[model samples]
Target: MPGDALVHRINRIQGQLEALKRIVTSGEADCVKTIELAKAASNAIKKFAQAYVETHLDQCIEEKVAVKELHGEMRKVVHSSFSL
Candidate 1:
């Protein structure tokens, strides 16, 4: 349930951000529309980061409880997502 909820939330935010990007570059809207879309994109990015951090914390707890070092194993995903 937690994983599903996390993934669903992230996906929805991603979709919204993508749509907003399209609107920003659609060339059919005014500056107000672009500004609003940019704000939406910023909010979506924040939400996505929060959701991902929560999910990662959950994963770390589950791994520690299970006596497994999944944190080290997930370096690729972590780096790709959190690093520039």
Candidate 2:
């Protein structure tokens, strides 16, 4: 619910997968099409994750800066961040 654009993008990606499934089930899709669909899905997910992580840092880490006792919080976030 963060924004209509984010939700719309997600829905469009979902629709693409559903359409791909129909193509495969109908025996119209081949290996190349499947791979391309997968790549598109991966790119969509990567972009979404990047936006989500940025928003979380802006909201949580910025707020944590006001608390002087949690000096290691940022370090922990960096260490535990996605290796991708």
Candidate 3:
């Protein structure tokens, strides 16, 4: 069940996307609502990516495959990615 939390996050994002789709197809889509849902989905994706990468990095470090130097590099990558 270690991945259960990640799966839950994915399901939530999927639900948001489905709602967005339903609204658009219903021909009564509220522009603000659609935008809000879209942004929510986008933020969820970013959060998921950050969590996944952090877990991977932790595993790598635990296994002695990741060096201290990689921390700085990974930090830079994560920061740059979220800056968008």
The TM-score between candidate 1 and the true structure equals: 0.51
Q: lDDT tens string, model 2, 1-84?
A: 566667776887798788778878898678888889878887887677676676565677667766664567766656666555
lDDT of each: 0.71, 0.73, 0.82
TM match of model 3 to true structure = 0.69
Top model by lDDT, which number?
3
The weakest ten consecutive residues by lDDT in model 1 span 65-74
RMSD of each: 4.4, 4.0, 3.1
Tens digit of per-residue lDDT, candidate 1, span 1-84: 767876777787778777776776786767786677778767777776777677687766675664346666567566876776
Q: How accurate is candidate 2 locally (lDDT)?
A: 0.73
Best by TM-score: 3
What residue runs in model 1 are displaced by over 4 Å at the alpha carbon? 61-84
For model 3, the stretches where C-alpha displacement exceeds 4 angstroms are 60-84
- 36-71 per-residue lDDT for model 3 (tens digits): 999999999988877777657667566655576677
